[model samples]
Structure formats: structure tokens, C-alpha cells
Target chain A: MENRNQITAKQLGVFVLSAQVGLGVVGLPSDLVKEVGHDGWISILSAGILSTVITVIVIALLRRYSNQSIFEINRHLYGKIPGQIINFLLILYLGFLMVIGFRYFTEFIKLFTLKATPELFLALLIIAPTAYLSWYGLKPVARFSGIIFVILFFFLLLNLLTLKKIRVSFLMPVGAADLAALGQSIIPALLAFVGLELTVFLYPYITDKRNVLKWVIIANLCTSAFITIIFLVTMGYFGENLLKMQVAPLFNLARYYRAPYFGRVDLFFILLWFPLLESTFRSYFFTTYDCMRRYFSFKDQKLAYGLYAALTILLSRLPKDFTQATQLGKVVNLAGIAVFGFLSLCYLYSFFNKRGVKAPCGKS
Target chain B: MSTGMVSCVTIVVSTVTLIASLSLPPWGLGLPARILKFTALFFAALFGILGLIVTASVTFAHLVTLESLGQPYFQPLIPFKPGKYDRKKRP
Candidate 1:
């Protein structure tokens, strides 16, 4: 029932932007600080560039196949049995991502604002809305991403307010982290841009195909710029050592600055960040459901959604606490690395696979 | 800040954006529709101030009711618009 071809390339830009800037960002600056000290921003920029180039390659592969998603393309190149196995792996990885993302947001909220609330209760609050959005399908999710784009501007403005206490010297010795550390941090830094993988499944649905490359690259650059500014601002305010010690450094930066008319700006930012989280959930769930719909041939999409949500909740509960949840997240991040590597191989196969042998993947 | 202060800021920003986006020229607007728009924006801002989840839910719900270029707000999801689907396939 999805009118997949109705989404404009510009909307695709917004969707990618939202996906790239979700829950991982909540802890990213601090994590980067720990790895590369004052040079964390360098790693962030490198990761952004790496993600952008990877996205371009994925888009190139999609262009060769016209209307088929990466899922169907895998089927074309690898045949049914192997293709379905790849999709099964992809689906499980996405499920792990959703559960990890859900746990991360809940832990952050429980730690900062809702200390008395049960973590499961907070997790349910997010799951309810994300389930509703995912049940509706991709266009609603895309439009929701566009709206989140606007809210991000407000978030930026709030972040800029921290400039009141910016110390220029704190960002000193910009490339202080050695080359080995900077290189090592790139993999972890990529956690922020994992959403770029959505481009693989989403490319065929783009309405204005000519603008696809343009908008997607632009979205990549936009996220990089935003992440860069946040890194610079937080580090300039708190410096690398202080930032490393703080959990959720960006939130803490916002928390320290207060205006006469506003109370706890960080809490306000967290509240508005809910939709971005939902968009993240929707992106992963939609991909998981698409895998099911494609391989299992589930004509009933809602049935797939129900099964996906149930699985996500059950897996999400397996991590008994935040520490275990983070460990699970690291494993999911490893899966992300594998998935992208597999996609690159799939792209290579698609180039050699003849056009005449390509199966019809249906309407875009 | 007190709840009243947050509500006041929310109302102002929401009202300003609503007025700017309204297609009806300020000189010719119906009072009831105008009031409805204001109320809707106010609650949206309030929901935003309350938490991220509520703000997102409210925004998504509002967007679903809208249309642009004769297409539904969620055209890709809904797909019921006439002639909107009549475009030739890309070669």
C-alpha cells in the first residue's frame, strides 16, 4: 500500500538528516573526547566525510538497479536463499539497533529528568508513538522527519546560547590527539552517522531521482556541520578534560547556562528531541518490516509491524541495566560495520551482474 | 522559569508562526478559523515545552491533516489524491 515513489528527493534529505542525528549524539561528544581529547572534532568531521562517501557509493549502486531497494538488489545478485539470509541478518541488526536506541534514550531521561520513573515505563512511552508512526508507513515518517528538521533549528539556537561562556583557549592544541588515536576513534565516531545506511533501502522510492544525489550529499554535509558546531561549542565551553568527565556533555553544557525566563534548557531540548528518536525508531522498524515483507511475502504489513515491535520490546528488556545496554549497543555497532561492508560487496556484485538478468522489483 | 512563563513564551512563538503561515490574508480571515489556528499552535508549543514525545506526536498529527500542491500531507503513505498519481514513469 506504500506509494513509495511519491516522496521528493528534498524530503529524503530531511529524512537522512534526522536519522543521522539521533540518540547516538547524546553521548557522542563525550565519547569522542575520551578517545581523541581536543582533537575529537577532527574525528567527527572525518567520520562525517567517511559516511558521506559511503552514502555516495550506496546511491551509485541503487542507481544501477532503478526501482529495486537494496533488499531486492541483494536478491538479484545473491539468489533467494543467500539473499534472504542476508536480509535476515539485516533485520536482526535493525532490531538490535531499535532496542539499543530505546534503552539509551530511557537511561538518559531517567538519569537526568525522570529519576523516580520506572525505565520500562519511560521506554513504553517512546515505543507507543514510534509504533504508531511505523504502523502508518514511510511517508508519515518522512514528513515527521521534515518537522523534526525545523525543531533542530530551535535546538541549535538553544545550543548557541552556551556561547555566553565560551573560552577560546579551551579549544587549544586542536590536533593534540596523535594520529593513531584519531584513526582509532573514527569507527566509534561513525555511530553518529549510522542512519546513512537508510539511503540503501530508501533510494528507489525517491520521487525526483535527478535530485537524489544532490539532496543526499547536502544532508550529509548539513549533519556534519551541525555535529561539528556542537563539538566545537561544547569543547570550547567545557574543554576536553572536563568534557571527558561529564556524561552527556552537550546536555550538561546546556544545563549550566540559564536565562532569566527559562529553567533547565537541557530538559527542554530533551523533550523536543523525542521526535528525532521516533524517526530513528521508525527508520529501523520500516527497514525491518520491509525485509519481512520482501522475503516472507507478508501482504499484511500490520502483522509484520506487530511482530517487529514485540521482538524489539523483548530484546530491549534483555539488557538488565544501562551498562549492559551499552555493551549490547557496541555489539550492534559491530553489526553495523558488517552490514555496510556487505553492502559494498553487494554493490560490487551489482556492477558485474547483467541488466537483462535483473528481476522485476515492482513499482517504485 | 514558572509554568506561566514557559506557556507565555510558547504562545507568542506559536502565534507568530501561525500568523505567518496562514494563507488567508490578515484582512479577510474568518474569526472562528483564525481562533482555531491560534489555539492549535498554542497547544503545540505547550506540548513541546512539556516533553519531546508529546511535541512530536502533536506535530505528526497536525501534519497528517494538511495538503501541499494538491497532495496529502503524507502523500506517499496515503496515496488517495487524484491525478497526483498520473505522472509518467521515469525511463
Candidate 2:
């Protein structure tokens, strides 16, 4: 029987794109500028290449056990006790990602749109829809992501309109930064690509296994190209010194544009981008909920959903302010790097152990 | 109140009414079903009254989650199916 929950390779591609290009895109150029000045686009491109390579390794690992998710694959490769420990750690890492995403999103909303709204209430506003969507499972999440992905094109179009104001001289000093600075910038750039690792969790659900890697690589490249364009535009518009001081260069770039009828384009941009932001949050929130459910073996979906929502709400409020939230985001980004390393090590271990290979038996 | 505030209040009230009408069955239902329906209505009202953007966003999210015969209701509208709108052809 065909599984109703299965998503096509195309849906998977857009899902990855939506998840990878969240609130991070807003601040990524600024963060990279701080490290490498005008060479930030180079860092983004390099991170894209590195992430594509990692995607290959991840797909190769998952293809070994094509029927199982990363959670089950962990158990199949390692012993039961160790595998469960690893699964728990994975759950914790996903939870931290969700919390950080939530914190950054709420902080952004508070700063830009709803200043008087309490952080806790803003968190609830996000989690309300997140919980509702996640309750149905990954298929709904993937479908929602595909829809949001279409809306993201408008963002690109808006950014393109700002090209008229950009001074090419601002980007002239490119490659002026030393290789060490460019290398340091790559870590922050890689952080923006963190959601691409979700491929492991999504691999088993994909109906067309043969094209999964191709679509995934395409998604990663698209994200890289998209962010690189934004970075170049931001740098071109603001130059290095001014761009370095911006906390959210993408928004500022949008704010720079003046729509004749709308007056402030930034407000309209925020309204358009709101769904994409929620989509990103939903992607991480769904994955975290899925991992938590599997780890605890929760039978009641409502119970699992309720607990996760409450936990997210409480934990997201831990950051007292925007700076603290940014600090927490940095911590999560480092942890994301660590998780990527751990996944690569698992692949290596599986490669050497002949017993780790399994026949394609379909879903666990 | 200003015109914007009046429009916001009208939107919230209309949303709450629509939610209650849609969620609650006219035929008598069980206590649990009634409570669940009322709770959803309450949330719709709360989100609507809190902020216009939040209410609109939450509604949009909810609308996307609606499925018909196991297929996304808004699939063709979103995710943009150029010619394939036949229900039987989907999936």
C-alpha cells in the first residue's frame, strides 16, 4: 500500500530550503561581515560547498538503511543502550535548535513589530500554529513548507529591486580580507546552513530515493546562491563599515527600499516574510517533537504535543533580551556544528563495520 | 476608537463568531466534544483580539492544514498545480 505520509523529492527540496533560510538570513551577512568584511559572500559560497559535501556523506549513510530514520539507524548501527543515548543527545540538540529559533524569532518580532507584547505571549503566538501543524505529522509540515517556499521568491524579487541603489565600488575590495578571516567567517556561514542536516530525518519519507541526493544538493546550492546574493547586495548597499554595524542587514536592505504606494516597504516585507519565519520554526519544532516522541515512546499525540509546546514556551523565554538571545543562538550554532561532526563520525564508523549494512526493508 | 481599531475589533469578533459556528455542531454532541469546540473558539478569539497579524497568520496556518480526502485542500492554490486540479488525479 502506498503511504499517505510520503513526500516527493521536490517537496523534500523545498522543505530543506524553507528550513535552511529562516531568521538566520536576516543577520547572516552582518555576522559574516564582522568576520571577513566584503569577503562574506565567499564564506557563504565556501560553506555551501562544504555543506553539499556533507549532504553527500549523509545521503550515503542513510542509503545504507533506506527504510529507517536516523533514530532507528542509530539503534541498528550501535548497540541498544548506546544508540538510545545517542538518540537522546540528538533530541536535546534538536530541542536547543527549536528554542533558539523561537527566541530569535520572538526577539525580532518584538523589536520590529510588536514591542509591547510579552516574550512569553509572542512565543505562544508562534507555538499555537506550530503545535496545530505538527500534530498531523511530517506530510503536513512538508506540504506547508512547499507553499512557503513559493512566497520566498517575493523576498528575492524585493532584494533585486535594491540593486539600483547598490554601489559596485563597495564590493571592489573583495578578497581584501585574509584567508584566516574568511575561514573564521565560514563557521557562522555554516550555521545558516544548519537545517540542511534535516535530510537524515527526512530521507525515509521521500518516495523517490534515487533523486533525493540530487534534490538535496540543489536545495543547498539554491540556499547558498540566495544568501550570497543577499550578502553581496547588503555589502554593496551599505559597504563594509556600515554593514558591520547592522544587526539584521537583510531587513535593513529591505528598509532601504521605498515602495511608491505602500510608503514603508519594510513593513510589507515583514508581513510577507512572517509565514516563512513560522515555516522555519515549524520545521525544527516538528523534528524536535518527532524525536521526543520516538525517544519516550509516547502513544498519545496530544500528550506529546502539549508537553513539547509547554517546554518550548518556557525555555524560549529564558533569554532575557535580544543580546542574550543572540548569545544563546551562538551556543546553539556551535552545538549544531558539533552535531554535524558527530553525524560524520557515525558515517565513518558505519563504513568500517561491515555488519552495519542492511537490506532495504522499508519503514521501521 | 479610531477606524483602524474599529476594523480590528470587527475582524476579531467576526472571526470568533465564524470559528464558533463552524466548530460546534448543531446536533447535540458529547461533553468532551463541546468542550474541545469551545476551547478552539476561545483560542481563536484570544489570538484575534491580541493582534491582527497573529490572528491572520494563525488562521492561514490552520487553513493550510485542512485536508480533503487525504490531500491538502489548498494544494493547487499553493504549491501551484498549473493544470492538475482533478481530485482523483492527485496523489
Q: Residue A230: error of model 1 in Å?
A: 0.7
- Predicted chain B of candidate 1, TM-score versus the true chain B: 0.31
Q: Residues B3-83, candidate 1, lDDT per residue (tens digit)? A: 555667778887897887666666555575566656556745543333445544754655664568755767654433454
Q: How accurate is candidate 2 locally (lDDT)?
A: 0.79
lDDT of 1 by residue, A203-262 (tens): 767777878888888988888888888888888888878898887876786688787777
RMSD each, Å = 6.7, 6.0
In model 2, state the lDDT of residue A37. 81
Model 2 chain A worst lDDT run, 10 consecutive residues:
A1-10
**DockQ comparisons of all candidates to the true complex:** 0.18, 0.28
Single out the weakest 10-residue window by summed lDDT for candidate 2 chain B. Answer: B47-56
Give the winner by TM-score. 2
* Cα-based lDDT at residue A103, candidate 2: 87
Docking class of 2: acceptable
